[model samples]
Target: MKACLILLLLAAVLPVSAQQLPVDAVKGDYIVGALQLPEAGVLELQSPDGQLLRRQAAPAGESEFRFVALQSGRYRAGLASPQSQGRVWLTEQRPLEAQLPEVAAPEAPLASPKLRALANELGAGTPAFWAAVQASGAPWIEPIPDHPQSWQVSFLWRGDASTRSVRLFWPVRQGDQERFARLPGTDVWHYSVRLPSGTRLAYQLAPDVPQLKGAGRQAQRRAILARVQADPLNLRRWAAGTPALGGFDNIQAEHSLLELPGAPPEPWLEPRAEVPRGRVEHLRFQSQQLGNERRLTVYLPAQKSAEALPLLLLFDEDAYVTRVPTTTILDNLIASGRIPPLMAVLVGNPTRESRSEELPCNPRFADMMAGELLPWLAARYPVTREAGRTVVAGSSYGGLASAWLALRHPERFGRVLSLSGSFWWAPARPPGFVAGGLDDAAEGEWLTRQYVAAPRSDVVFYLSPGLLERSAPSDGPGILETNRHLRDVLMARGQRVIYREFAGGHDYVNWRSELAEGLIALLGAP
Candidate 1:
């Protein structure tokens, strides 16, 4: 029993008129209770330990008091004069409300001409309309006659009386959920998007998602995951029984695959029967500079050469090895002579915390890579010592670290292949520094400014960021914007740069294909 409850029981000798109202609330809930007091008195809010938290003045007769439960715990409100008491239990559940967007009526102007014509002819949300959609399959894709490079993709959902809203969950721009508008007097809910012809991604659909009112916007938006599932109408999916190319296990957690006609083919992802396979050796490497140990995976090419082989160092070892099929890609590239036979070192992080600490332009991490890691590899393998033959590559923060390493020690890493590099990162600011507030002048794009100030180095860069990675207003510049800025800065300084933007997001699926392209661009056989 709580100390507050013990105190309340001990004070039972005082005359009580009416029972106090008990409250069951969620965290962030506004809790209100009424006390039947004979005369005006003070109500004290106490913690579980019987310590007074706050006091509120209660009027005579029926007195009311309110409290905002910011955290999950048991609290007590008691009137000292009448000895009436109330208990409140606050849970961790987020307070949710209905925040659904108003749906467009059937008579409203539909974005797609097909949807408009269908609505006018057969009336949307009817049995006939659903039959037609089922026959044609979803999401209904149509070619834009005027714009050959783009396609109109419409997502559809069938809802019942209980369904409040629907959302499309995809690797969309900055990971925003797309809302579906319901048709009046019908079960049909639809959302249409114009995507590039080369768009390839996986998506899920959430129906009747709970809208959190008291939580942050991101928390409310993520509530869709409770009801998110693969689109039933979408025939293609990324799940079990599919080729082992970095996919999911079960259908419940699966996502529907969306590959447009013009999407680039992922040729090197699968292991080929004809191609010679490379050997992957896993070893635990202890770093003296960072005072930690991590796993390092080395890939030895199938074909052995007399001279020292070119070296490729990649960050996020498990991801590149498993999700990306990096060794298979290397085998295909080497066997086809698209790129020369080279050894690759996939570096793993000791922990998630260490990765966040070290990979964001940390000089100690750069020192460890150049001084300790590379020398250790050189002693074990016949890897090239020349900088031109050495390439450092990664995605996201790993990408940022790759650029930073190359920039700091150009003689160690001559080429940097950064996919979706986070150039928006700056040095750690003092506590309580808002992201884009008044003190934001020296905040973002730290690495970009460093390249501008530092002397020109003999380094080449292959940088790529997804077009969908545009930053929100509050986040300063995002990966796409910051990467473009970095590219421009490098080119202005007469540095060799090969930059490209794909119609995708910050996803591993896109990075897998881009990795092969980057390797072929930088180290392809001449």
Candidate 2:
């Protein structure tokens, strides 16, 4: 009886006829499995904590399954029956070029054609090669022989024996970190990427990022911030403190600017010595509808007229005033006759939380803007009451709010200027819906659907979304896709729409230039 009980207990504790095979794979490689099953079952790929990552159906005959390893970790693969089980260990490896950099001089081939040619001439990773690179400046931008629209950008870092890793903190892709590969037997590390000729962005480099053992992926990734700083080789710096409109709080956190040759000209960014300036008055405004008090920065054109001037109500007052030179842009545009003389009310948020609550298609907020704020502004200044001459403009969530307000009160705001609008926003989601997960198709594009359902209004729109604002595979439609969808919906309704895609990301750096372009498109002189 004791022996029988021991055998039963062992059977219950151990897997029956199951073998766990250890498999190795590199990050970004797909792991495929061919299996023979006696009965129809399901194959499941799970995380370390047993959370199902993927599932595939397996028939009673031979079957195959594949899963891409996105990160370095241990994953569990199992069938419905415990007889088939395996463990996968995914690790990240440097590219082949980085591992084989000691090839014969003048005959060696490299992943980058430019680097190959340079290696043929001066030898790879030699002191003379580095001297030439330093003199030529970086990140080294070279035109692709056949591709005129794109350029190859190579970022280089000089590392010593103590250096373990180098990461690039470019904000083009969310939650993705790029690393530089070290050349074999040399102190040179490099990573190259292709970008459109019109690309303009800010980036930082993190050298020797510490490895945090047993920490989550995000916590480990964020540890790079300890060593993150502007590129030493890149001379151009962004957000260096200038003054009221161009000042940043932290000078040490300044990023290196990368402006391609084809980037659009920001003619209105800096104050011109020849152009007349605008006056900005700071005042406190209290909203009874929303029961909040906030600051408002009012911009009056240099040339004052007795007649009512066209009005612009822009959200995120502080950002427009400080991060972007709004007053300077307005002055230059008005002086050059690109746009008519206009008065602008830069709307401020009462609190950060209030901005979240009020900016995303809030009816009460739109009502306050139309019923309370419009009347208040008309009483204080010689602003227009006609909708055709009035414009509501903002970026991101504020962009969504601008469209919502105009749709809610067309008589108050006829023109909407939205830059990288958050059109993939829905008011509600189904229970257990995970954002940016595999099953994220619950609800989105609420405002676009609202436009389709509601009657067409006499509202003109200027929509601009960056080409780089694309979402990951798990996430739903991103800013660029949703903006295009909104533009199509507006055109289908016979509304006048001007849509453009910029070769940048959802950044204030891009929005500053896009703002002037949007104003010229909507309210420019005919």
State each model's CA lDDT, in order: 0.73, 0.72
Best by TM-score: 1
lDDT of 1 by residue, 412-462 (tens): 999999999879888665422222111355488888999999999989999
Off by over 4 Å in 1: 1-109, 119-122, 239-252, 430-442
Instruction: Report the lDDT tens digits of candidate 2 across residue range 1-526.
Output: 4534533453454332232323333443334444444433455566544577644444333444444444556666666456644322222222222121222212112447777687679987788988887787788888988899999898888777766677888656543567778777777778888889899887888775544334476545554544567888888888522111111111125578999989988788988899988888988889987777877899999997888999999997756776688999999999999999999999976644466567878778888999999999999999999999999999888899899998889988999999998898876543222221112444788889989988999999999998888876656788899999999999999999999999888677788899999999999977
Q: What TM-score against the true fold does each predicted structure earn?
A: 0.74, 0.72
Candidate 2: the clashing residue pairs are none
| lDDT of model 1 at position 52 | 67
The lDDT of model 1 is 0.73
